[model samples]
Target: MTSRFTELVVDCHDPEGLADFWCRVLDFKVIDRGEGKVEIGSWVPTVEEVRARQMPPTLLFLQVPEGKTVRKNRLHLDVSPVDRSTQDEVTRLLGLGATTADVGQDPDASWVVMADPEGNEFCVLRTLAPQE
Candidate 1:
């Protein structure tokens, strides 16, 4: 058997803020909360695992020292709106403080690459049919 991919984790100085931003972006919820950690997941886990058996399968938002620069994102999320045009979504995100990034995409293209408030780059692609 081979290992499967799991959740993506992000390190941030403001855990609550990042978690809230991601919740807004993905329409997900803050499934778990702690003093210095927060978790966001697409779906809630139903099974309870004991001790080391638990997989801890959720995107972790860890608190770090203030004024920390994000050297590289160990993981990033690409977001696209479900029922809105990509242009509209990009506009909305920009209004929400996301800015353009240097992804080498022409300005006329259907997809726009943007960085979140913390400078994490994510792509907003033109709408395609949802995968089954």
Candidate 2:
């Protein structure tokens, strides 16, 4: 028996805005929506191929009155660019409303800590070759 990730449910004040932001960041698309939630799924062929056994996990943004807190999140996402350099990707993300974030990490760390428009923290990992 094996288990595969199917969805990542995120609580947010504006499901529409978060979905838009993540869609651009991940090259995803808004595929579904409900009364209080929006689901974003992948459009990348490689990503879909990697999850051939089933569909890849969708980023599900659900409605929440209280948004992110002042304290850091217990869990955060780490992303790697498939084709572009890490610095370029980070710069593009910054242009898309992402901001550099600090969470007490050593300055020499490889990953770039960043926060979304809603202040959720995620890391931009080292870039990977397209073949990777």
Q: In candidate 1, which residue ranges exceed 4 Å CA deviation?
A: 47-57, 66-75, 106-109, 129-132
Using TM-score as the measure, the top candidate is 2
lDDT of 1 at 64: 72
lDDT score, candidate 1, position 75 = 56
Please give the range of 10 consecutive residues that has the lowest summed lDDT in model 2. 43-52
lDDT of 2 by residue, 39-122 (tens): 998843345454567656789999999977766889888999988989999999999999999999889999999999889999
Q: What is the lDDT of residue 6 in candidate 1?
A: 47
Q: Candidate 2 — which pairs collide?
A: none
lDDT (Cα, 0-100) at 30 in candidate 2 = 92
lDDT of 1 by residue, 1-132 (tens): 334344567767888887887777777788988999999977676543322254535677888776545554545567767877787888888877789887566778767888888788888987653545
Alpha-carbon RMSD, each predicted model: 4.6, 4.0
Query: Would you list the C-alpha lDDT of every candidate in the order shown?
Result: 0.73, 0.87
- Model 2 alpha-carbon miss at residue 101, Å: 0.5
- Give one clash count per candidate, in the order shown: 0, 0
